[model samples]
Target chain A: MFLFMKQHEFVPQVPYGTRDFLPREASQKRAVEGALAQLFANWGYDEVVTPTIEYLETMTVGVGNDLDQHMFKFFDKNNRILALRPDMTTPMARVAATRFKGSPSPMKLFYITNVFRYEQAQAGRQCEFYQAGVEIMGASEPAADAEVIALAVESMLKSGLQKFQIGLGQVDFINGIMEQSELSLVQRQQIKHAMVTRDLVGLGEILVKSGLSQSDQTLLKHIPLLHGREDMLKQAYSMVTNDKSRRALDNLANIYHLLENYGVSQYVDFDLGIIRDFEYYTGMVFEGYTPGLGFPICGGGRYDTMLNSFGMNCGATGFALGIERVLLALERQGIDGTQNCKGIYIGWNKENLVKAIKQADTLRDSGCSVELAVIPESCAQAKESQKSKGYEKLVYVE
Target chain B: MTSSDMDYLTIALPKGKLFAPSAEMLAKVGCTAEDLSENSRKLVITNEKEKLHFIITKTADLPTYIEYGAADIGIIGKDVLLEEEKDLYELLDLRFGLCRMMVAVPEALKREKLSDYAHMRVATKYPRIAESYFHSMGIQMEFIKLNGSIELAPMVGLAEIIVDLVETGRTLKANNLLEVATIQPVTARFIANRVSFKLKFDRINRITEELRTLLEGVVTL
Candidate 1:
């Protein structure tokens, strides 16, 4: 029985939490990537590439412990710990600090790359995912952050995303206020975890356990509650008393107004509770979302200190959009992405085989997508099954 | 709030302790989940006048529905929210279903402080929360995942301590257990699908604002 079961068992699957994209799906994914690439290029972001596998320390350097745990790691023949790049931002930072040293100020670099993470598989999350992103180095102005965000909004709209938003927040505000408190490291971590998880009740309990002043606790609770239109900024303004916290609010407000100048303020909103990926972002942070999707399709922020950790004293900010997630968002909007390009199918009988080749060549020379397939003495088979798979125009060589 | 338009707002709710109070609040602000509650088997209750729909599901499933876009809005307890950790917007704290997630042990083991039980066995339905809780206490604990009857673990010595939800001391007292630590307070939160909050901003904002207004008097607590 054991031998029979072993013989019948189907082995060598695609492995759990991974995926393979069919041609149509791959084209759709490329379309999203191309749209984002064109926008990044138009905004002066030069495309860049990094190794898919790097030394484990290089990939994990300056990353939060959470990111490290998700990374897929292995050892090289040289006994060096190597890992698949879990994210492009840190690798980009490493490159900008080393390879592009003194290249210029504010180097605008972009990439479309796939990353690997050993994460639990679920809806909209695959172990091997693609990210298209841009990183700006040596830029410190609010406009730089504003530029990346504005481009993100434009790219989403340009890609046919009808409804979406970019939630903007500053890491220094909440962390700054907590830094002033006498709460222990564990207490602060617990509270920050609660904030990022949107757990107000848990945050309240932690604040109480830390024995903060009653007014401080109230202020802490009220800060995360700040959301909605610009008026919510007023509540945030009233709550921030520390100089650093107040300055962070001012930076956020400035970015808000800058996005307004860019005419994309409607796509931008503020959230004080956003502190995810805090190990990387030092100041302004933003996350992109559309209706019906739970996870953010895109997330990035300012990481002025990250490059410095890599031995370069430069300021930087950037954003990355997951290719698969953008497709899902488009699907939610009933945008299947097959509407734009349809292939021309050429069916050849024995009588017109040479003519079919010439006709296919003619169509290809005319900048049309052509799919050639031999018919079984009839064109009926190609005609019926082609429409659903995006073959709009058909040519009968016979 | 009902319109002839095709787009309508869908809300998912957990079908237990928080349901009645949540339904009461929803009724005040243009939705009535009680209509579907009249028939125990009906999962969906609709209000044509308001164009609002409610899907009643297990409390643990509310986040999955919101995450997968089956439901645009949900009202669930903070415990489940923390346990599931789905990516939805916590728009408002409904300020209802007030309870505490506590670390409890049998009264017979109350001789030492919590730190004394380092590397001990702890049981809970929320292993992530329990792990973090014990981690903060500088204790190394083995977590045993139990879906229900968490109190029985400590009573029968399956685990030295249990972390479970408690609204009243009656159950713990009947089982001869003493509450040793409080992790977090539990309350019903109004969560909106991240995408729904954008496309349906006007409607989602109105509902969240109305609910927030409802909690103005009791928010200080």
Candidate 2:
């Protein structure tokens, strides 16, 4: 007998930033994605697909230096460098520019895809995760922008989210501040770094060192403190005398008015300070959040010039919801995205083994989830001739 | 969902201009917070009848608190809401503490024809908001992140433009900077932690509804 010499048996382990979803988790994810897909479709956003891998250059540019460093880069068989998409937006942008160039304007595209980013895994953040979102191309109107925010709210509500908030801000507002400041790039970065880390003393000292006048220092010191609701807009509006600052305020006012008209003002709030992850968004940007999660559930903004890099410039605003984060939120809230599951658990017996198998099939065919006993007769008999497997409504046939 | 068991509704109050006013509002709502205003100490105060507890935190941390369920409700500026982008139900407008986030550039760079610097170096505390604005204008620029002293980035030639929150243009005028754009106007709000809103619906809703009525009166003035 030829005993085929054994090959090396190695312990199984998943690659870092990857996971194997068990049955329960997998089923739950599928159910959540299905509900999200239905919601997206209801908004007339058709699903689209993009490659998970792309040439390094196409995905690298405009992805930002910080993100560029994190991309999982490797070489193909031909030795050409490639990267797993760190975000869906870049891939979607490529698709829009190259493939759907002539298709139409205002293309409402939705996608359920995995994006890879190398970061330390924490509470709601995974190195590799799924995102379900829509990118509305070819429009920059406040109404269209408002539509994205509204759809996000509705999608979350459909995902069984009862309590959440959306923070809206205008990118131009900060740009107006920068346009009026004399701070250097490095100084500006240091200041932002301090503010993001909540270093009030550091922020105060930086303003003083920037050589800003006493009045400028006072005003700059208050930047970290500005935030909250509508009337704050008026306070913010009062600060800017120049037409540029006034225009940015006006843009925010218009958006607020539009959101009010959409009947979503209740769920919406304003934050003039929210600088997002992307380096590309220009006009209005926003993020959605829930209390249970440590990070934003979704985020996007008006990347008007993102397409310009692809040689097509059009005003656009959109947001993306992290499916995994949303799922985690739903779980925390105890709202099952899907509740349908099998109730039948089959018991084993030496004489009834065939019958159990046939019965399991029958139950499954009838749209019931059934678990068949896999143990042999000895173990099965020792436990019980038949066991209900903890089902509240257990059935056994002799 | 009945949530009568969760009695004390925790609140995150951003400490600043909105801090005092929000504390007063909480007092008016019967939520005591004397310890919050005390200096040189970390204190968390709770009011039994009001069924509210207050956590004094950074303006930016208010949303984080609400977002993380650490605080059932929070008081924050509209500007922080715009920047941090947390998901909380803005239950009411506190009608105080207002500001503006703006785009500015050195006076010399201001007239250089924004299009001329295709690759403009921009500095701002609000990078996401700044990037979105320039993106809409079809302008591409490198973002230099600064927490404070955004004005310095322009003066030192690190970036030509700046984006920071502005309450008054006196600073810009003093710095010889010009405003190019305004991202959004700001304010303070009564934001609800999502789960708290759901679990303590009746209590939180009652308090917010009352505060809403009071603010409606203020807004008219």
Candidate 3:
């Protein structure tokens, strides 16, 4: 009983909100990531890998204190705080500002790596997750934003997703309204908090208490409902007379036109309420969604101000797709893209071990995944092994 | 699968006081089904013609259904939303099921202010909201989590204070509990899954607009 208790106490377990992807899940993740890497590369983006741990100051500088609670922070040797990166965008921006500072005019980069975030773990969301993303630095034009959005759509397609939409919005659209309004800072923050959570009811209550004119309150309340195609943009244009908001609307239109040229406008829509959770996003923002998933499968936007904090004063835009989310969406849609079948299972009789080894190597050389049996086996056993192990064929060496 | 199944919109309705009004509100938007009542034995009711699906759920679990996309939309109370804190789109205030979350103490305590007692035993069904409220006020207390009949806690000496929802103050009066502070007003809210709000924008938006118009008329009155 004492020995049993000791054994039970020593039983291994993974940390909470983390998972070990066994062979099948790992293969599916790899396949989807491989397709995304190829797609990003075809779009003229080079891949970059960054350290998983960074000084807490660097991450906070890029993201903000809002995500500080979510980071897995610990003290390093020198008592300096270190945190597992909660995202790749900040690290990518860090790389751009430091290593790739004088590389080129338009530095296009991509990364497929895991990030850590301490949060409630659920389907498609874990404390540690994988993301495949790309960034384009040194370009401030709408074309760059359009390229990123188009690539995001293609990334979804490449990951075996058939039906999805990108809800595109510009941050300045709301900033313009806030600037034009005479509300105090606290009231503005309350409105923004309500908007970020998509709490229209709370937004309505705040606006009513904000003492703004009835027209302004109505306009503010209608922002969350401002979602549709190009014609909705015209309606939004008529509602806001401020130059900042007008310029934002025009920027969205230009990006939309470019997306149309990319033949991806069919999968895009204007949702002026998409104030993404990231505070660093300066201009256009977007989130990708599929039918069966409750949360966004991918999201990103332009962050012209992030790199500037790192001392590189240039504009940049990028997007990231959740690998697990893509896999979950594919599963829910009954789409299977990962291949896990071995080519052959080779079994050997008493004197044919050498032959079986040679045959396995030959099959592997010809691009077949062959699994050779360790001990001697009969033909029937070899066939049974092949059937049970999901090998396509069986080779018995006698 | 039938074509209706392809575009079916699933709504999760809280099972208690909010059920009847939520069902009625959905009916006004052309989404109705049979036996969708608070006491009905049926858990799921479908309106095939309107391509609408409704699932009756416990008040606390309504947000969970919406958050996981098990149901596209849900009608839930703000008090439960505060405690559960699920990430969802709070689209509209249905304006029914009015109540307030209050911190109450027994009348015998004679302590009208919440800050009077620096340390006290508190009981609540909404531990998160209760803890956060106390923390915000710089109060220190031990919490005892109870599911129902929170009013009986203070009377039985299990706790000195209780945090609960007061719809009419009649229950508190019956239990000899006096309200010390009001946390926030509570109401039935219409919420939706983030992805569902975008993918089914047209249908959901139409229903929301219809409901908004109806509620606006009521407000004006």
Which one wins on DockQ?
3
lDDT for B41 in candidate 2 is 71
Local accuracy of candidate 3 as per-residue lDDT tens digits, A1-398: 36656754677678988999998898899999999889888888899999999999999998997899999999998999999999999999999999987887789999999999999999999999999999999999999999999999999999998889999999899999999999999999999999998888889889999999999999989888899999999999999999999999999999999999999999999999899998899999999998788899999999999999999999999999999999988888888988767678899989999988899899899998889899888888888888998988888899
**Model 1, A397: alpha-carbon shift in Å?**
3.0
Candidate 2 lDDT over A361-398, as tens digits, reads 98889988776767545543523533434443334433
Better of 2 and 3 by TM-score: 3
Model 3 has an lDDT value of: 0.90
Ranking by TM-score: 3, 1, 2
Tell me the TM-score of chain B in each candidate.
Answer: 0.92, 0.89, 0.94
Estimate, for each residue in B1-221, the C-alpha lDDT of model 1 and write its tens digit.
11112277888878888888887888888777446572367666777777777788899998988876678888999899888878777767677899999998888888478888787789999998999888887889999999999988877779988889899879999999999889988888888776565556678778877877778856666
Question: Runs in model 1 with CA error above 4 Å?
Answer: A1-12, A179-187, A228-235, A374-376, A379-390, B1-9, B28-30, B38-42, B48-51, B88-221
Reference-based lDDT, residue A227, model 3? 93
Q: List the residue pairs that clash in candidate 1.
A: A290-B195, A291-B195, A291-B196
> Which candidate ranks first by lDDT, i.e. highest?
3
lDDT of 2 at A314: 75
Per-residue error (Å), model 1, residue B136: 6.6
- Which residue ranges in model 3 land beyond 4 Å of their true spot? A1-10, B1-6, B38-42
Q: What TM-score, computed on C-alpha atoms, does each candidate reach?
A: 0.83, 0.63, 0.97
Which has the better DockQ: candidate 1, or candidate 3? 3
Q: What's the TM-score of candidate 1 when only chain A is evaluated?
A: 0.93
